[model samples]
Target: MSVYHRPVSNIWWLKRKPYILFMIRELTSVFVAGYCIFLLVLVYKLTQGADAYGNFMVALKLPSSVALHLISLAFVLYHTITWFNLTPKILVLYRGEERIHQGLVAGTFYAVWAVISFMVVWLVLGV
Candidate 1:
């Protein structure tokens, strides 16, 4: 019987730009999940009555919370951008004899995302 051992370095992903970006994209999920949980808590607070919701808003207004939210927003934006860029690879489009350009596919995704996001904001604000 023969035993083989392999060692993995902590900064292995650092060896390549793509690998680092991939790791960052994977880690962005944690921040996204955290933001989702934060929203859920806000919803729970709303259910608890106006006072609870007010308190939660106040807590969120704190500097630390603001910082966390900003950091989370950055991660979410990066995650979204990477996913949008990868869409062409995940979804193939053909124009009869030729395939659509990757940039066009990604641009379409961004346009739709922006439109939907704007609609959501408008609906939420009633403005």
Candidate 2:
């Protein structure tokens, strides 16, 4: 049989985008890890005494670091939303018909997040 194939298009990431996106998402954690390391250093500096803590704070307040933080926060927010959106798929609990229960799955995920948030605020505010 003679072959007849269409040209591949840029929009056709159906086959590649998932892997590409997964790699992008995977690498994005570098910023998250870096943030944690920075926090740990801050903690260490605080324990070392006030002067060290002040120096750490001043270093963090540098313009370049401030910009890095803003960008990392944006990346983190995007990562969190995308990650939580996929939580329902992994949690995979059902309450009704498959299509109808999808809402339940999503709702439950958000509900848990809300509860955890409440607990966090209560702890932080000493309520």
Candidate 3:
């Protein structure tokens, strides 16, 4: 005879879901890739002819298409941040044979992204 026990305390984060989060985060990466490929294909089709371009726009009007884009946009935002957060683990940065903190690296990535975003907007909008 055996019994399983679940913790009752509200340590919060430890008690929360992980597998679901992992799946969501992984799916976000897939969406990011798929979204880019989809845009590329749409561009290619639009360049082919008016009929093909009309078909693409018609597909966009479908409910499934709208849902896909909405989900993709949400996932993409999460993916971007997660990618920055994971950069330190993937790359080796040693000033004098010592590893750096992941947060520091991720912060740097966020800073760079912000600066580039600002610059691009400034150039595009003439600000």
Candidate 4:
């Protein structure tokens, strides 16, 4: 009988900076998904009644909930930035015979993200 060896180590992803960042980016989705569920719960609370919604708002104001939100926010920002950085690889642009620079591609994504974010804020605030 032949013994099989495991191909991967638990710390394999931490061997390099890029690998560590990639793992973190992938992990961020969990927090993002949790936040989405949290938002859905908030909406459900709103549907229940003003009192439920008020209770949810108060719960969100608790220090533990605030810390969780702040941590989730950090993960979300890291995920967004890393995703934007990788956009150039997935989105190829050619102008005539020449391919566009990667920096330009990432810059364009960042610009579009900023514009869309501003638009969302403007609409939300009615400003």
State the C-alpha lDDT per candidate: 0.95, 0.78, 0.85, 0.93
Better model by lDDT, 2 or 3? 3
Write one digit per residue (lDDT tens) for candidate 1, span 1-127: 9998889999999999999989999999999999999989988998999998999988988999999999999999999999999999989999998999999999999999999999999998989
Model 3 / residue 6 / CA error / Å: 19
Task: Give all candidate RMSDs, comma-separated.
Answer: 2.3, 5.0, 6.5, 2.8
Assess the local accuracy of residue 46 in candidate 2 as a C-alpha lDDT between 0 and 100.
Answer: 81
Locate the minimum summed-lDDT window of 10 residues in model 1.
52-61
User: Model 4 over residues 50-100: C-alpha lDDT tens digits?
Assistant: 998998989988999999999999999998899888999989989999999
Quote the lDDT for 71 in model 1. 99
Model 4 clash tally? 0
Model 2 weakest 10-residue run by lDDT: 93-102
Question: Lowest summed lDDT over 10 consecutive residues: which window, candidate 4?
Answer: 52-61
lDDT of 3 by residue, 32-63 (tens): 88998998998899788999999998999899
Clashes of 3: 0
The 10-residue segment of model 3 with minimum total lDDT is 7-16
Model 2 clash pairs?
Answer: none
| Higher-TM-score candidate of 2 and 4 | 4
Highest-scoring model, lDDT: 1
- What's the true lDDT of residue 126 in model 3? 100
